[model samples]
Target: MTPHELETILTEIGLSNSALARHVNRSEGNVRQWRKGVSKIPDDVAEWLREYHYFFQKNPPPQRKG
Candidate 1:
């Protein structure tokens, strides 16, 4: 996905760059670079985010969905 799209997803998930970095095991600088458009997200990272989006949409955490 595009950087903006990723950013939107991050926002929807209520995570900052640091939180997302922790979730994905990436560096905070990498997340910041992606957000700043200074770097592109790797395919694996994109896939991870897509999976997360799907999981949450289809089977969100009980508290969040409920």
Candidate 2:
């Protein structure tokens, strides 16, 4: 995916770079690179992000107890 698309998806999912990195089993730096267009986003990661975005839209996460 293009960096712009990746950034948009991440925003839609409401996930920080660190959170995405954890979910995708990658380093935060890797996610940063993808977001910045410094590195290519793998096809698998892009696919997973798209799926996650859909899930996030349909079933937003529950609020944390405080």
Candidate 3:
């Protein structure tokens, strides 16, 4: 996904960069790079995000809705 899309997802998911990095088991620097469009998200990280998106679509967090 594009950086803007990723940032929107992150906001929709109610996660800051640090929280997202922790959730995805990636470095905060990597998350920052992704958010800034400084680096492309790796395949594995993209897959993880997709999976997370799938689960989230199925069962969103209490504070968020479709």
Best by lDDT: 2
**Cα distance off (Å), candidate 1, residue 30:** 0.7
Taking the tens digit of each residue's C-alpha lDDT, what string does model 2 give over 1-66?
Answer: 899999899888778999999999999999999999999999999999999888888998898999
Off by over 4 Å in 2: 62-66
Clashing pairs in 2: none
Local distance difference test, each candidate: 0.86, 0.92, 0.83
Residue 64 C-alpha lDDT in model 2: 100
Give me the displacement of residue 1 in model 1, in angstroms.
1.9
Which residue pairs show backbone clashes in model 1?
none
> What's the residue-level lDDT of 42 in candidate 1?
90
Total backbone collisions for each predicted model: 0, 0, 0
TM-score of 2: 0.84
How do the residues 1-66 of candidate 3 rate in per-residue lDDT, one tens digit apiece?
889878877767677889888887889999999989999988787777777777887997677658
Q: Which structure is stronger by lDDT: 1 or 3? A: 1
- How many residue-pair clashes does candidate 3 contain? 0
